[model samples]
Target: MALPDMDTSVGHSFGLEVDGIQIKQISEVSGLKMEQDVIELKQNTADGKYVIKKLPGRPKAGEVTFTRGLTSDNSFEKWIKDCHFGKMSDARKGGAVIVYDFEGNPIKRYKLTNAWAKSLEISTLKAGDTSVLTEKLVVTYEQMEAE
Candidate 1:
């Protein structure tokens, strides 16, 4: 998939009071394939200091399914509580990098992380298939946790 223009906001995340503690969704004008990695770049304008915030790659297609609403079934909720959260937090360094997408939601208590990648709409959705994009990308975090 080719990169999409720098749209500061590509998707959104939400935290609930039920099994689905946190959720993020990026609309695909094209299609969202699995196994592709997404990165959130944090560049400091003051000194050009930047950090890469990468989310775990999408599980191979068919390994997981996307649903209409947030639920325990969501993979993010199942992997956010691990050390990866700390890693992502550390990457941000001096600022308050808490998950803001789920703004005002108490479920944010679980060290959450969500951000948009440059854009990969031109990419195709393929399962069990690998692409060069996966290499440029890395699984910076494990997964988000579920309530």
Candidate 2:
């Protein structure tokens, strides 16, 4: 008997892009959730028995958070400011979270639409501390689809 082919691809977490431009040095990505609302319907049958049925309602993708060591790049900060000033047309961006196999081939992709930064936070600074500086960003998206 011959054995069937099995999938053994590993996930790659660091390759991310926004508006087709690659973001660098991202160490962690979290809070990526795709959810759908459930609608319950209670119906009575002719036998006088009531039952509840669950139906899919709408798509509700949660926010995504990115954490990275601070670098010389200020593009993200600029973009956040632009969004704060009500320049949504320019602030909104399309992004993708990609997962690759060990051979460097893309295995999965999560496409994000109309995404904008919800908040940006920097690690606390101390005069004599020797910790690495980091930036954390919270992002919200209008839609997300996995392929």
Query: What lDDT would each prediction earn against the true structure?
Result: 0.30, 0.85
Q: Which ten residues in a row have the lowest lDDT in candidate 1?
A: 133-142
- Candidate 1 local lDDT, residue 89: 37
Cα lDDT for residue 57, candidate 1: 57
- What is the C-alpha RMSD, rounded to one decimal, of candidate 2? 3.5
Top model number, lDDT: 2
Per-residue lDDT for 84 in model 2?
Answer: 98
| C-alpha TM-score for every candidate | 0.16, 0.90
- In the range 17-129, model 1's lDDT, one tens digit per residue, is 22232333422112222245666665666668666666665543211122333223433332333324455432321111122232343322222133212211123447886
8-50: candidate 2 lDDT, tens digit per residue = 5444444788999989888888988889899999999899999
Report the lDDT of model 2 for residue 61. 60
C-alpha-based local distance difference test score of model 2: 0.85
Off by over 4 Å in 2: 1-5, 8-12
| CA lDDT, candidate 2, residue 75 | 69
